[model samples]
Target: MSKRYGGKFSPEEGRPPQTPSERGSFRGARRTRAGGRVNLLFFAPLPLAARAFGSGPTELALNLTALGALLLAAWLTREGILAQEAYEARKIARRPAIPRKMFASLLTGLGLGVAGLATSGVSAAPLIYAVLGTALHGFAFGLDPLKDKGMEGVDSFQSDRVARVVDQAEGYLKAMTDAIKRAGDRQAEARLERLQSTVRDMLRTVEDDPRDLTAARKYLGVYLMGARDATIKFADLHARAPNPQARDKYLALLADLEQNFTAKTRALMADSTTDLDIEIEVLRDRLEREGVHLETRDLA
Candidate 1:
């Protein structure tokens, strides 16, 4: 207290004035803080998102891998559907008929591909393709006029023996079993037993008549036709019943039988030795031109 003249406070009683360097440092600190805040707003999201997933590049790669797997699954499923349609067409025509069902399957596959592009998950594409394929297969099998002519239903006696020709050409017993199981019939067991008996008889007959390949072939055809018919009937029954396990068993059996018959037929036919004599072959060729096949070239 030295007496203050006009009420001006003394330096000791008031706050001290800032120095020039101190003022500059204070302003610099404020600017630095503002810049730091802007950087945080801009860059914080990137690190935060990265951390939420896992780590930076590793997390991104995992997401990409998952997306790729989904796409591949979808594509394969679509292709599988198309293949089933082709199979159905061949079965129905009792030969390689690749028109209506094939076209439909292709269209369905394309649609499934488009769906996969729009959707997520592996199941979406595969489930869509499988469902469509199965539906089409069932429809084709149901409508197939040649279903009865399958190796499981061929007659032993006939001049041309259409059944025998088919047995030697395009026999498929396993396919019939699959058809029967899919159809879901209660009588499948009974029909299967009958078919087995027929097959045993044919095998015995063929063994007894070893030199008669023609007769053996005929009996084989009858056996095959019986098996095919059983399968068709089984399918009909399964369609009514809806048994997944039974259907799977049928499908497996069908595949096995198809392989067996295919191998047998190839072995039998690979010789290229026709029973028809050259003269008979020439006559047969002429008859084919008229859309006919001779029962016996000389007899016809």
Candidate 2:
């Protein structure tokens, strides 16, 4: 997946510093700064006018126009920015940012502005535009707490947990698959390596936390199913070789390896370590169907 702030995905390599929660926090701060900027944009000309010209009717009118422009800009910017930032951040941080309701104020502000513009009479056009601008100002600023107040704590905890477990699983699988590639059958080996890395990522998502456990596990289960299918396909290809004797030997070796693979996976699944148990169960089931038993090992 293409990460916005981070580079390409590498299962074993350390991620580009910022975690999902960190990204969220950064986004929140950016929003706050943006709100401040919007406020400044609205009032910017007033200071220039005040410093350059003493209070006067012309200056007052110009300041009002500038203020209205700022409000309109702020309102329009919030929705687009929120949507864009959320989309980019999703690639790296998969969680659904619970308390998604916090953005309601922004929607409310944007709605009021649109409604005011739509219903205003010709004579009231300027008044309606000014009201819309105010609404935009409110929307841009009203969601500050949702972005800041205790949000980072909740998001950070889950982000770090997911990252740590994901890093470990990916590292382990990468090492194992890299070793297998040196034994010949590079194509099959490459497929296995890729499958394992994919599985590692899915597992990390499922293993992240219990909040969005249902969705995470569903996707993770699919990845495991794919992995199992890949292994089975490899076995099938080995069965149709030119030499019957060589094919039989290859088939026997694969069977032994698959059996061992099952046991090893079962061991990993059996561990009661992570907060997401439902995902662990789903992963175990998918592997078991393919005759690969996963054992969960407890660390503490």
Model 1, position 66: C-alpha lDDT score:
35
Query: What number of clashing residue pairs does each candidate have, in the order they appear?
Result: 23, 13
Candidate 2 residue spans exceeding 4 A from truth: 1-154, 197-201, 207-300
Tell how far residue 252 is off in model 2, in angstroms: 10
Cα shift from native, residue 90, model 2 (Å): 8.9
Query: Please, what is the TM-score per model?
Result: 0.24, 0.23
What RMSD, rounded to one decimal, does every model reach?
36.0, 20.5
Per-residue CA lDDT of model 1 for 1-300, tens digit only, reads 696554346555556675322232123222222233223323322333343266455445544443443344334333434434433423212332333334434444443443333333355774676457446534532222223222333333531243334334334544654564564454554344334433433343333333335734643666566557756765676667766776667656644554454445444444323533555678778888999856763544
lDDT of each: 0.44, 0.44
lDDT for model 1:
0.44
